[model samples]
Structures are given as C-alpha cells and as structure tokens.
Target: MTVSGAARGMLRTEVDRSLKTFLDHQRAVGGGPDVVPLFDAAEDFLAGGKRLRPAFCYWGWKAGGGGDDPAVFTAAASLELLQASALVHDDLMDNSDLRRGMPAAHRRFQALHEKEGWNGSAEQFGAGAAVLLGNLLLLWSSEMWRTCGLPAEALAAAQPAHDHMRTELMCGQYLDLLEQAHGENTFESALRVALYKSGRYSVERPLRLGLTLATRGAPPWTDALCSDYGTGVGIAFQLRDDVLGVFGDPSQTGKPAGDDLREGKRTMLIARTLAAAPPEAAAVVRRLLGDPALGAEGVATLRTIIQESGALAACEEMIKQYLHDALEALERAPITTEARTALADLAVAATTRDT
Candidate 1:
C-alpha cells in the first residue's frame, strides 16, 4: 500500500479497536434487559463505518508534528461515536428506512415493537427509541473523548473546537429542518445547510481539534489553513452525497436508488437542476419530488431530468472546483510531505464516489 493507503488502513483498524473496547466496557458495566436492545442497536450502528471524521483528525494531528501514539488514535476514534450519533438522528429526521442496507435505528425498534406485540404505536416507540439511541451515542462519544488518557492540558486546549463542533452541528441540523419545513430552497440556502449540517463537523472542526491537540499554542496561520482546506473538502463531501443519493449503487451506498428524491432533500444538486432545466422539466421535478412510494419509473424520470438538465454535470464540476481549491490550500500548508499526501488523499476520498 502507498503511505496514504497504509495510514488509512491503520486508522480504520485502530479506531475500530478503540470503539470495540469502549463498547465492551459499556456492556460489562451492565444494563437492564430493556436497555440491552438499545446497547445492541448501538453496537450494530457503530460497526463498519468509513471512519472519515477520525481519519481527518488523525492526519491533522500528524500534520501538527504529533508523533505516532495509540492514545491519539483512541481520542480520534471518539469522532466515530459523534458521527454515529449524528447519523442516527439524521436518519430519524429523514424517516429513512435503511442505513448501510440494514434497517435504520427507528425501523429496527419499530420491528422489535411489532414482534413483541407492544401496546403503544410501533412507530412512536421506534421514534422515541431512536431519539434515545442517538442521545446514548452522543453521551458515549463525550465519555470516550474525556477518558482517552490524553494529557488534561492537551484535551483542554482542544475542548473549544470540540464544543464548537457539537454546537455547530446542532445548529446545522436545525437549519436543515427549517429548510425542509419551509420548502423554499435556494442554492445558497442549500449550501448553507450543507456547510453547517455536515461540512464543519465532518472535516473542518475535527481537523481543528487534532491541530489544537498537537499544537497547544498553534499559530494563526495553521488555523486559517484548516478552515480553508477543511471547509472545501467538507462541502465537497456533502455534494458528493447529493450525487450518490441519486445515482449511487444500492450495494455501495447502503440505500435504495433515488432515496434522496423520496426524502425531499432539496440538495444544491436539485436546486441547480431546477435552475437549468426547462419549465416543463422543472415542473415535473416539482410534481414528483418527495413521493413516499416513488417507484423505479419515477426514479428514472428524475434521473433523466437531472442528467439532461446538466445538473449532475454541474454538481460534478462544483465538486471538482471545491476539491481544486482544497488542494491548492494544501500547497501553502506548512506540514510534512506525508501529512500533505494523506490529507490530499482524504480530500479526494471525501469528494469522490469511491469512498
């Protein structure tokens, strides 16, 4: 493997190990039978993710002159829990049925309720369980970060960025809900949602956290570099998700084709399509967008509209432009050559279909 590839592999392995250890500790602490299912759900949801956030944090630490240390890996791995927390809540908010080709947390609980012939509404039970599960993951993420055995001083330095990441993500989630409810989505509004909802937490703040941890007295220039490069990569990452929601392989993406259309995401990709499409085509999109029982025929029609309208190509170009900007920021970053290569690889992974 190349250096970057090896680093990613190591990150995947170490983060997985750290998460396993933490979850195991939780299990050993003992919970009631009712909560066992929640624990099981947490374990299932936490397993086998891409671990993208932690990788960015790890590479950020490397860039800041931090040495190889498993404690840093443990600390970085906490990001996986935070990410899982966000996704669980996001899936519930979107009413998504599946996650990674398995039933979503809410759906899983709904099934359990139905199986048990519970008295309350299965849907309500599922929704409530999902909310609690998401909260559980968030709590676990905080605990993991605190007990990662890092120096108190170092953790203290990174705490502000960590707090900002959590706070910004919640604000972003609120913005997403507001956008969906109002149903008046401009490209600019969609971009703001993307940046606040996914961008800062996914890449920017994680990088900032790592940088701060490594350089307790980090320079202003380093912070600027993290913002510029990380924001570009983060926004491009969400844009890639926009494309995947429409055109991705079900097996690869762990969701049905055109699920985003069914969910009425109102992504920038869709906004751009509407901007460039003919009046009739735009009307067709408006007519078909958000049908809960959207069929393959509907999906195909929307796909044709997106492609023929040049929205897909336009989104692709935007991703390229953002990636180009992110990489250019790297040119001015004062980091090791290896760190640069790893961060570049990560940026590409964030933007491309492959990861």
Candidate 2:
C-alpha cells in the first residue's frame, strides 16, 4: 500500500477497535433493555462507514507534527459519532429509507415494530426511536472526545472549534430544510446550504480540531492555509454529492438513481438548469422535480433536460475549479511533504469519486 493508504488502514483499525471497546463498555454497564436496541443501532450504523472525517483529523494531526499515537486515533474517531448522529437525523429529515445500502435507522425500527406486532403507529415509533438514538450518538460524540485521554490544554484549545462545528452543522441543516420547504432553487442559496451544512463540518472543523489537539501553538499561516484547503475541498465534496445524487450508479452510491430529484433537493445543478433551460423545459423540470411517484421514465427525462441544458457540465466545471484551488492551497502549506501529499490525495478523492 502507499503511505497514505497504509496510514488510512491503520487509522481505520484503531478507530474500529476504540469504538467497539467503548460501545461494549456501554453495553456492559449502562442502560436498560429498552436502550439496548439504541446501542445496537449505533454499533451497526457505525460499522459500515468510510471513516473519512476521522481520516481528515488524523492527517491534520500529522501535518501539525503530531507523533504516531493511538490516542489521536481515538480522539479522531469521535467525529464518526458526530457523523452518525447527523446522518440519522438527516435520513429522518429526508424520509430516506436506505443508508449504506441498508434500511435506515428509522426504517429498521419501523420494521422491528412490525415484526414484533407492537402496538402504536409503527412509523411514529420508528421516528421517535431514531430521534432518541440520534440524540444518544450526539451525546456519545462529546463523551468520547472527553475520555480520549488528550491533555487538558489540548482539549481546551480544540473545544471552541469543536463547539462551532456542531453549531454550524445544525445551522446548515436548518438552511437545507428551509430551502427544501420554500422550494428555493437559487444557485447562491444552494451554495450557502452546502457551505454551512456539509463543507465546514466535514473539512475545516476536523482539520482545525486536529491541529489544535496536535500542537500547542501552530503558526497563524499554517492555520489559515489549512482553512483554505479545507474550505475548498469541503465545498467540492458537497458539489460532488449533488452530482452523485442525480447521476451516480445505484450499485455504487447505494441509493436509487435520481434520489435527489425525489427528495427535491435544490442543488446547484437544478438551479443552473432552471436558469439555463427554456421556460417550457424549465417548467417541465420544476413540475416533475419533487414528485415521489416520479418513475424511471421521469428520471430519464429530467436527466436529459439537465444534461442538454449544460447544467451538469457547469457543475462539473465548478467542482474542478474548487479542487484546483484546494490543491493550490496545499502547495503553499508549510506542512511536511508526506503530510501534504496525503492531504492532496485525500482532497482529490473527496472531489473525484463515484461513492
């Protein structure tokens, strides 16, 4: 394996070990029978992720001259809990049925209700259980961070960024919900949602938090450079998701084709299509955009309109630009060469992947 690949493997192993240990400890000592399913759901949900956030954290620490340490891995893995919480809540909000190719947490709970012939509305019970489970994961995110054995000073430095990340993530989510509700399809608005909802939390905060934990006093230039890199890559990551939502193969993405259309996400692609297409064509798009009953034929028609309107090309160009800017920031970063190369590889992967 390449250096970055090996490091990633090691980090993944460490994170899995630490999470299992912590969850097992929780299972052994905490909660009643009602909460056991919550713990099980968390473990299962956490087991299948790509661990990208933790990888970013680990590489950020290395860039800040951190040593090879298991403690950093444990600390980095805490981000997974935060991600799990966000996804569970996001799935609920989107009313999505699947995650990572499995029934989403809420749907799983709903199924459990049906299997056991439990009384009460199955959907409501599932939603309530999922919400509580999401809450549990959020709480555990902080708990894991605090117990990761980092020095008090390090935790103190990292706390502000950590806190800001959580707040910003929720605010972004609110923006997304607001846009969906209002059917706001403006490109600028979509960009704003992407920035707040996924970009900062996914890239900037993780890098900042890692730097704060790994070093007592990084130079201002280094911090700024990391921020620039993170922002560019993070935005690119979201834009890529927008593309994948529409065009990605279901086998790779683990979601049906045109899932975003069904969800009525006002992504930049849709915005651009609306702006560039003829009025009648745009009307067709707007009409069919959010229908949950939209079938494969509808998806194909919309995809053709988006493609012929040049919106897909436009979004792809923007992704390339942001990725270029991110790599440029890496070029000027004052980190070690190994760290720089790894980060650049990660940034590229973030932008240029099918899943």
Candidate 3:
C-alpha cells in the first residue's frame, strides 16, 4: 500500500480500538438515569470526528523512534480525547449545530430533552450537559497521559510542552472571540490566532511530546526541528481549512458551504480580502462578512469579492511557501530517512487534500 493508505489504515485501527476502550469504560461506570444519558450523548458526539489530532500524535511518536506499543496508542488516544473536549466547547461557543455531519453535542442533548418531554429549558440543559461532558473528556485525557507507561522523567519533560499547548489554544480561542466581538481583527492578528490555536496544539506540541516520550533526553536541536516542521505544517493546515470553509464541496467537507463566512470567522483569508479589496468592495465585504443571516446568494457575492480582491491567490501562495519551508525543515532534521519521507508525504497530503 501507498504511504497514505498505510497511514489511513493505522489511524482507523487505532481510533476504532481507542474508541471501543473508551466506550467500554463509560459503560462500566454506569452513572444514574440522568448522567447515563449524558454519557451516551457524549459518545455519540465523539463518534464521527476525523481523529486527526491523534493521528498526528501517533505519527509523531513513530517518527521520534517510539514503538507501536499499547502505551503509545494510549498516549495518542489522549490527544483525541482532548480534541473531543475542544470541539464540544467550540461548537457551544460558535452556536454551531452540526459537526462531522451530525448534531453537535449540545444539539443532541437539546433534542433528547425535547423528545423525552423533560420539564426544563432544553437549551440550558443541553449547554450545561455539553460543558460537563467536555470537562469529563479533558479529565480523561489527562488520566490517559498519566497512565501511559513512559518513564517519569519523560513525562516530566513533556508536561511543560503539554501545558504550553493548552494555554496557547485557550489564548488563541479568546483572541478569536475578542476579534469577532469587537471587529478588531487584522491579518497579523488572524495569523497569530492560527499559529497558537491550530499550529502549536495541532502539530508542534504533539511532535515535541512524542520526542520527549521516546528519548531519555532529546538533543537540543530536536525541539527546534520539530518547531520548524510543526509551524509550517500547522499553518498550511489552517490555510487549507480556511479555503475549504469557503470553496470546498459541502458533500465531502460535511459542512454547509460558506459556514465560516456565516460564523464570521476572522481568518487570514478574510483579513487579506478586506485588505486587498477595492474601496467600494471593501465596504460591502465589511458589511456582510460576519452576518449570520447572510443567504446563499450573499455568500456567493462575498466569495466573488474575495476572489476578485486577489486574496484567494495570496492565501494559496502563502500555503505553498509554508509547504516549501516544511520540506526544507524536514530535510535538515536528523531523523531516519524513512521517517522524514513519511512526514513529508503526510504534510503534502494534509495541505493538498480536498477534505
């Protein structure tokens, strides 16, 4: 099989096994009537995600010379739990209803509340349930890490990186919220959010965590190499996501067309479009950019304005530059040739993939 095929197979196997274990554990813990339903809802929400973070963690571990032991799988699985927690909170914050082609956690809970004729505000119940469930997932993630059979020294070394990842993500999320609320976003600010929110947590820290876990003491250059590689790939990944948010076919993406536009995401593409649009076009864009009530026709018009403003081309260029830098960094790293090649291929697949 091709490398991509092999990676997909590995990811599928790991995700399936991890999810089964997680579900079995949940079942064994059998909370009372109310909480049991909540657990079921959480499981349903977690079921359909792409498991991208865990796959990244797994491959990062392999690249850092870690074997495919059960401990490694558990460690990788922790990242997926973290991802689930983040998504649950993210959807609530975004007021989003759909995720991975199904009702979001909060939405599912709300529907269940209504279906069961519960005597409470379904919205309140849903949000509260989702928040508690998300916290549970976060706790579970930490526990998974604690139980992974790595040496204490390795765990100690990884703790700071892990903390930094979570801290940066929270900060980035807050920054994004602030920008959207105040209409204070700029291209630079968007780039900063992308780096901290998606870049570090999504790629950098995972690579660093895997490296720390694998080696008794990683060389000084190891962290630097991973940083360079991670930043490049992470930036490319977010940019591609931004593109897909607007231009991708909804069938494959499992999102409504122009969902990001509807949400008024302060993405790099939007910033660039605003910056480069003609004066008249800029006014129109600014007026309609984040309007949640925008219709499909309005979204089409905004897309046209962005395309005509040259922002799309600019974003594409930036993606290519990042991909080039990532390849260069990979070449310079002291990892095995096969590992480096695998990383390169994964990077390409990540950035160039349509879904």
lDDT of 3 by residue, 186-241 (tens): 88888887887777787777777777777646777677767788889988888888
lDDT of 1: 0.90
TM-score of 2: 0.97
Q: Candidate 1's residue-wise lDDT over 163-249, tens digit each?
A: 989999999999988876776689999999999999889999989888888997679867777878999999999999889999999
lDDT score, candidate 3, position 145: 79
Best by lDDT: 1
Q: What lDDT would candidate 2 get against the real structure?
A: 0.89
What is candidate 2's lDDT per residue for 263-325, written digit by digit as tens? 898899999999999999999998999888889999999999999999999999999999999
- When summed lDDT is taken over every stretch of 10 residues in candidate 2, the lowest stretch is 1-10
List candidate 2 stretches off by more than 4 Å. 1-4
Ranking by lDDT: 1, 2, 3
Task: Flag clash pairs in model 2.
Answer: none
Error of 2 at 3 (Å): 3.1
TM-score of 3: 0.94
- Which of the two, 1 or 3, has more lDDT? 1
